[model samples]
Target: MLVLAIFVGAGAFIWPQLHGYAVTGAAYGARVACSCRFVGGRALGDCRKDFEPGMDLITLTEDTAARSVTARFPLIARQTATYRDGWGCVLETWRN
Candidate 1:
């Protein structure tokens, strides 16, 4: 029971930080992938090569019809970015 309690405490402390990182990672991945796919004319699968190190947990999906990319960090966070003619890639509005 002590070990379980310790794990719970550790999770409580770590979860917020982990969620923050996931949110940033997801947003970055979505924007970068969107730009890569739309502006650079690259395949969505190839866009993973553009991610910074330590972003391996982020995964990307594309809506070609919408010219948008969505990135997810497992169950932690998800974000979408869409390409605009003049604005390049723009992130979706965040919702509470």
Candidate 2:
């Protein structure tokens, strides 16, 4: 059907934008939570309050040994932030 085709085309174009927003939001939440926990000397449980808007739907994971934190935006994207001794939090980029 023409309407179905049109709807599919619109969704194909819009999905990337929506995914990008999710990725950005998750990355931001991860970075802030990482900084708050590692550099700011806060508890991981307490860092939930620092998440960016819309990040409530994301799932966060922290690796203490790796000094990193990751945020997963379900069906959208995942991002990680690493904490260094001198630096606060560094966001990791996707590789080609």
Top TM-score hit? 1
The stretch of ten residues in a row with the least summed lDDT in candidate 1 is 87-96
Which portions of model 2 show Cα errors greater than 4 Å? Answer: 1-6
TM-score, predicted candidate 2 vs. hidden true structure: 0.84
lDDT (Cα, tens digit) per residue for candidate 2, span 1-96: 999999999999999788888888888888988998889888887998987555678888999999899988888888899998787799998521
Candidate 1 clashes: the total is: 0
lDDT, each prediction = 0.93, 0.85
Name the Cα RMSD for model 2.
2.0
Deviation in Å, model 2, residue 51 alpha carbon: 2.0
Per-residue lDDT tens digits for candidate 1, residues 29-91, read 999999999999999999999999999889899999999999999988999999999999999
Steric clash pairs (candidate 2): none
TM-score of each: 0.93, 0.84
